[model samples]
Target: MRRKEKLVTVQLTGLTHKGESVGRTEEGVVVFVQGGVPGDKAIVSLARKRKGVWNGFVKEILTESQNRVIPVCQHFNYCGGCSWQNLSYPAQLALKEKVVIDSLTRIAKVSVNSLEPILACNQEYYYRNKLEFTFSNRRWLLPEELQNDVIDVNKNALGFHRPGTFDKIVDISQCHLQIDLSNQIRNSLKNYCLSNNLSFYDVKNHVGFLRNLIIKTNENEQALVLISFSEDNQSEIQSIFSFLKNNFPQICSAYYAINTKKNDSWFDLQCIKVYGEDYLLTNLHHAKYCIGPKSFFQTNRLQAEQLYALVKKYAEFQGHENVYDLYCGVGSIGIYLADQVKNVIGIEEIPEAIDDAKINAKLNNLTNCSFLTGDVKALLNDELKSKFGAPDVVIVDPPRVGIHPDVIAEIINFAPMKIIYVSCNPSTAARDFALFDEAYQIERLRPVDMFPMTNHIELVSILIRR
Candidate 1:
């Protein structure tokens, strides 16, 4: 019960976000054990206590799980990239499906029969189209096994921060979860920064030049954006830019934004153009989408196409029904389904994404599609209903936090014939779905593996009138 005192043998039921096992004691104390799979009997060492939950590491695995497999990635546990690498791909998919079903039934008051089969992705690895890495001032020190022979922590720039330790960063050469271009950009930037004597950002002090690097590739275009804390010397930055342009000509657009904030997120920052063009263009089938540094796009490109296709299929538009797209980032879903419907209206909170969405609509000559910029809850209220009229079909694709209760109430109040809910977080979606349990009957649910290696998965559910 006490920290570091109880060396108990517990069975790991499942894995958590930190690649730890989900186990519970007889007295209902939750046990989170590191490096143990489901059905494994693990001897754990208690690490800390937080809000009554016990965190620990697996000192020994007394019995192995039948489903456990050898992790494929060389930097599996240390890299903080793939949490479910130890789990077989099939098992991972199965558990994700179960998580969706359980979340809906338990939290949303929906039946199992209402859910549909998960659309399994053909390719699991190297499906990512975008990868972002922060350059850390301090390199992560190796364990005692290789401590003496490790690289100097002060001199080298680290690639990604390790889990639960913001101060420590692991210098990575490659990540198999992303395509080849992602690794190339990360590795190249690290080398460039090192050679140029550009300082990497220190999380503790919040100082340095090379802050964050974001690489995005599309069917026809690729973009690399570097955000720095401060631009002390413009000529030096230009030299770096020239080298990048010469080396990676495929990068049509390269930019650098100046953000002097303490937070890692760039939601609010005055971005300045440092090089090349302004935006990155991505072609999705027949449609084209413009991506800004602040705009939101699905990280997994191939699976996103499938996700949009599934959403379109569920919409069942007859070129007459008017559609409403909630949380439409860059209007990817709205634009994709625009031709099928008479008119599509997209509502988003961020003004920047809405601007990109407008540009995308104009680029595609989608006169039928229109976008409004405002918060979801406020936009879906009386103002939206008065302006656009009630839609025939409503498509809601909220963030990981899920749809707010007020927005859910608005959806229920408006009462569209068909409701298509797309969610990245099943737990929150299920919670939000419960609010409309009385009026709408769960028609079908499909899970899409947007992120293959990690524990995260996307679920799309369609609800019909009872």
Candidate 2:
């Protein structure tokens, strides 16, 4: 198909799941424009066309929407971190609620009994407890910099990857996502590397010493810094680790890993502790958690507490009810509800997460929680149920793609009294819920804005067997 080069004016009516603004051409063709707000008239340049849908970029804002607002971040436009930052928080919440409703009704063809008001974040910016920045040799240049006669700019960047560009990174001066300590740690490391002539990772060529930096903070103000390097340079690693440890007394734990692999996945890779304890301590409600470098905790700490509260509410766990937490990462949800239920059985695929789950259960001194490591689809069978006893309530917190078909089949076979589903992706949740509509009736749904100023929203659903 020939690419559409002509610029077309569109009246954006809504926002898409990927944070793009939705509009239709005069002929009824759908167009998704990036950085376009709803209820705005924009001139968009079409970038790609496929199957009656056109993807484009906003070329000119002919009429601004009432929902539009000036973004606080200077890197809002070029950096893909916060696409909905231009829209007001209330507008963002409304659009997200609409997205969930559309996904449930239109995609899944399921009716919801009730939807509670979206739980908004108390603090919007800097609500994220974790942030990971990439080290790239070729930084993405802005439009003005590209047009400059003298193209003199620092090529080394330690920030997020540009949207739709894997090899290119945006040089961030200040990121509004995480706490102020994150910015300080990132900037100090970047400056130290640049001044010491340390190499940044060349994503295309796959060569460099510095690869990625990850910073995680908990509710208690304890921080953990993890540095991933492509090559093992002990001297350089020790120097940087020591520098961060001495400079930032708030960093309770410091770890480093040598990841020579093609991808940035270091979960399976061994992480060497360079300073302090091997794990950072965090508490939610009354339960304590030990967070390792590879641990899976919710990014938004404050909202996570709210999300877990909703999960607990939907589960409706009585003191004698046995609860099954499926796809339980680190047993956060199960452990949170351990005290309320008779016994909590947590199942996860990753062994490391299961390990963390066990540690967390011990840390909380809960003897009723049992965490098993295996695929939910394979492990959730009649034999497993016989061994673990039938669950009175089942709480599932699946990944973005939602639950597997086989897992759904297993869940149906188990047929717990109540099923509480926690989903990060609404479309997949809707689809999965549709499958359960045959045997279960939807009772209540609560949407939580765990990530503010972003298109992503978390949802909790309650289902009772019909």
Candidate 3:
């Protein structure tokens, strides 16, 4: 007869992709706990069981890990933003390096010759250039509040969603992710809405005035604020925008959109500018980029410079190579390297991003760069090669899901002399690397820590055609 276990105390030895700690039972059954760190001996209550795997939550900390430190953020546990805040910075980098190596070795079955050390960020906190906060009518209550029977707390929250709960939000007093002004803007807006009797969005019923707030800052200290409203109230919208413009003089641009759809996505909805310019400016080395409302730019501006440096170093451009940049958003990478390359062609699926890319190229005064709007898998064919000239080098900075297999096939068919891949997700990158194992040999692998105090890591891989 098999033994049925209720609650088990196990020793955690490893970490997972989503920052969960891994442990095993005496029977060698793997268990995952959210708050467990490596070298932690904790009492966990198994909450879920499936097949041979078990999931648990930490009930009590029997023995804390050496790498564990007191998280600085007050909203560390409840907020879904940063999970590894308890772990030290050095420890986080080490674990991220291990994650990359493990995924490549285990999932891709490819042996990397040289795995360089992770490039740590100089500014860990307040490194993000962009942050999005949701306005929720249902606020998640703290354990202490529930126990003390505190019912006078304000129910409206303008902050991040609670972990594993979509409708509930944790009211954030301060967020260490973005600049301090972000907190000021969000809190002020929340107060203004409350005072003015403005209705915050209820995700369940989808009825409210305020839907979502997006804040972005550039290297020049210029700020852009974009708000989404579920209902069309021009008076309220103008009042809020005017208040922001008058109070926060740093906010150079302000835009608003009315999104009545069940979802909060404002990509398809038209945004109307109420103040200042329509776009914010960002720079990478010598190249300047104009970031529009829907443009996709790297959230970590400083680390992005280092990441692109590695990409340029690995590509080894000699001013005569024709380069093709796939999944190019705003032409940041391509424009940065255009001066050193013969000519560059960038392809992106989003039309707005392509427009920004073209505008950025023109702003940089690079006549050798061309931006095209289309699906890469459908665009990279014999005709494209004939029109744009065969690429001497190809650079791919794909999404977290990695590139489509058909797109990989097309790249292989084109057979560029060199391929530089920049990925935010290691597992998907490893899987994609496996597809190129037959034709390309891995030359260099460099991991860049774009996001500190979190489990997310970025990597740049250089492969040469065999």
Best candidate, lDDT-wise?
A: 3
Q: How far does residue 427 in candidate 2 sit from its true spot (Å)?
A: 1.6
Q: Ranking by lDDT, best first?
A: 3, 2, 1
TM-score of 2: 0.95
- Candidate 3: tens digits of C-alpha lDDT, residues 1-466: 5346478888999987888899976667789887778988888888787576788878788999999988899998789698898888999999999999998899889886667888999998999989888998899999799879899988899899897787999988899988888888888888888999999898898788888999998877778899999988889998998788888998998999899998878789998899899899888887788877778898998998999989999988888999999999888899999999999999999999999999998998999999999999889999999999999999999999999999999899999999999999999999999999889988999999999988898999999999
Which pairs of residues clash in candidate 1, taking residues 3 or more apart in a chain or in different chains?
A: none
Instruction: Please identify which of the two predictions, 1 or 2, would achieve the higher lDDT against the true structure.
Output: 2
In candidate 3, how many Å is residue 108 off?
Answer: 2.6
Candidate lDDT values, in order? 0.79, 0.89, 0.89
Two-way TM-score contest, 1 vs 3, winner? 3
Query: What's model 3's TM-score?
Result: 0.96
Off by over 4 Å in 2: 1-6, 25-29, 50-52
Q: Model 3's lDDT to the true fold? A: 0.89
TM per prediction: 0.92, 0.95, 0.96
Candidate 1: tens digits of C-alpha lDDT, residues 273-309: 7666777877777778887777788777778888999
